[model samples]
Target: MNEPQAIAGVPLRWVGPLRIGGNVATAEVEVPLATYETPLWPSVGRGAKISMLVERGIVATLVDERMTRSVLVTAGDAQTAYLAALEVDARLDELREVVRACGRFTELIGFRHEVTGNLLFLRFEFSTGDASGHNMATLAADALLTRILETIPGISYGSISGNYCTDKKATAINGILGRGKNVVTEILVPREVVRDVLHTSARAIAELNVRKNLIGTLLAGGIRSANAHYANMLLGFYLATGQDAANIIEGSQGVTVAEDRDGDLYFSCTLPNLIVGTVGNGKGLDFVEENLRRLGCREAREPGENARRLAVVAAATVLCGELSLLAAQTNPGELMRAHVQLERKNATTKLGG
Candidate 1:
């Protein structure tokens, strides 16, 4: 085994454990937020007039989602693929109950199948409560595969991940079917707030989004998203909270919208594939657990609720940072000027030390 490399740690900045509510019976909750140390974030916060709300069942759908692993059998040809597909279809009710027995709050959402040459590809989707459902979906897939092998004649193992389920990497399927929390964050900045705080106008911000995020992204062949630098905020938040930072790949896929409604600027961000969880994997670490506790995520009424709460707050933070950056870009040299100023201050502090 190769030895681990020693590296200096990056600075971490905690922003808000700000209180926000959802459109549900659950009480308002606090979500602690942080960013990997960056001079830019403080500028973003100065003009943000943000609001957040969580939608429950939609986020819960992340847990209830399913994954299917298909196999090829010696006795199976294209005809066998058809027959096996029918057999699996006929036993949908039985298969769902089988999956439910594997875990609490598990539900089979649906399944699909295809035949390429003689290979049979079957995919299943489920809802796993409170968890991101990666391992849980795998376990259910394994058990479901066993049932297929036992019941369907001549069927042998193929691969557990058919890539039909589509994890990690960005794809159209997750955007359409909906994955993780569907958090929508909105901000309304009065024209005065825009000019005074952000140093730009509502019309300018709205036009910039259309030109840069929408038309510009299209010209560049961007995939199912239209936003600038969502990954910047999300990566920082994930690292500080002990989340699987890699999920930032899908997590960063989102859209930013701005309208010069009347005179005030209206801005919003919709993140559909934010795969995050609070009670598993990295949560046991000292700092991660402490952060969760401070955010009020560790004390939710149920296992999955805390994760949902975290997701909304996360979406809100993304909006705050995005709005600030776009506003800064409206002026010719504002972006680089801010960077130079912040970095110079940082260097001076280090020299004094």
Candidate 2:
């Protein structure tokens, strides 16, 4: 497949190209950085400018990685639930062994139990190698459940997924326990860069974040999240990279924080439920494979490392888009004008062709 051309007047650069995660033998992957111009009035084009800064190493991003999955098991009665909990704790070592035996890279991290009168729900968390671990977690949960039933008795099979895993929905659980790759992407934009490039001050941006993202979201009844349009960039990137786009529902649940550090802007996006993986379903398509290969996620020493790298890149891209859109909002009429101009240009070009 051909390499991606420039978009939104921003040049594309391959950033990082660095060796990430465990093991030194894995191939070094570079994330593709492109300029993105927001559709807003006044048209600041902060997206493209932020891309340039990321490519030039002016902004630093750190990735906290994990490949997690949760499974739910229900018990018939409270007494049964209590007994099952005791057995589960007693066989923790054996359960880990069962998980290891089931897959080379699957590890049982931890488990939680909740009881509502007679019903008991157990959520098992796992670290599946290189994969998003949805399927892996389910399979491991099945085996473990079977073992528990045989040993404990009086407990019936609840479901492969009890919704306690909280797959595609926005909930407080995923934010607290964390699903997929929990990534926090931040950039420290210089005071001069903020004014000249972003066309706004750090204080303006921070105050807007407080008023719009935090307070506005609270007033609007946002559930455990305060961010503007995280799904925009995430959906585009996920589609290009072969991720399950529906995961964007929970993936969009994140917080955008802007701080005025002296005169500079410290902007970050914390995405807790970014369910992404390098190798899994939908990743085998030719275009998807090409994208992963280009992004340096196709090769890694371990199973989960590549997925972690992909998560970091995805988070960083979201941050760039968020910064651009927020900056555009700082100027009156800029957002709507840019949209009209860009959309009209596209329509005109199409009609001309």
Candidate 3:
């Protein structure tokens, strides 16, 4: 409802204390959503134009009334940090599968990592160039930590445990194990139907792909998800489970777009930076638990339910984004403006009421 107040630079929120390789540090930071919009960009092909249409559309619809807090995770050694990265990577894989299954897609590039032992605290980052994979990354991180505790012997099964921990939608928790300081992951989508105009109408293009039966055909044959979808889905999942949402922007990266000689579309997504945990600040809400239930992770149980659910959600998001983009690529401005106007009308109705 209210415009976000702008500062010269994005401010970082203090998530909590993290231990990295024998050194304990506090993690603090938040990435600003890039709002740069330019009109002079060229379109995907000749006789077209691209702008901030897609970015605007998705952000407008998905990020309503939600905000993410900062996070910090500490690990005892580099091995722990590396393990954390592996955990994030595992989650990203789940997301990618979902995206591809939703349509025909692949991961052209992907990455995962973590930062530990900073006086400034744990630094977390993630991004998904495809649709949105916040949930995938977050849930993965939580599951990984919890799994470690379960598998490891005499490892305190508590705060540092990545168990099913969801605070309010606005809080964060620090999962500490063997002094793990910070953890992060990132992924991106490289394959898009309309590359040039992705920034403008990404969601539209994905939707179009489905509407035009482009994705349906791909799905019928068989579909695979991309790393980018996984990255974004993980981030979104985390945000929903009381993790920071904005961190997802950097945690996910490396998106690629592919098309055959006939212009048949294929895409790939990847994310290597995911820093999230499930044992610190925001695991104390009733509604948050209900939301997790919707995702199928009622508690930290055997088989890592939270992590698995995150993977499925990532796949769903990728499918949705792919379909959305396909439809937009075919219809262009028509679909793009439809939702924009709908949003405006809703605002007007609310104002008038």
Best by lDDT: 2
Lowest summed lDDT window (length 10), candidate 1: 53-62
In order, the Cα lDDT scores of the candidates are 0.70, 0.71, 0.32
Between prediction 1 and prediction 3, the one with superior TM-score is: 1
Candidate 3 lDDT score relative to the true structure: 0.32
Model 2, range 232-328, lDDT digits (tens) per residue? 7776677767778789988999999999999988888889888888877878767678878887677646667677777877776677678888887
Off by over 4 Å in 1: 1-8, 17-21, 24-37, 47-79, 351-353
Task: Compute the lDDT for candidate 2.
Answer: 0.71
Give the distance in Å from residue 124's predicted Cα in candidate 1 to where it truly belongs.
Answer: 2.4
TM-score, prediction 2:
0.85
> Tell me, what's the RMSD of every candidate?
4.4, 5.7, 18.3
> How do all the candidates rank in terms of lDDT, highest first?
2, 1, 3
Give per-residue CA lDDT, model 3, range 92-210, as digits (tens).
55544443442231221233233444211222222322223335335433444444445433223223322212122111222211011122211122334245434334444444434
* Model 2 weakest 10-residue run by lDDT: 18-27
User: Model 3 off-target regions past 4 Å?
Assistant: 1-238, 260-265, 274-280, 303-305, 326-330
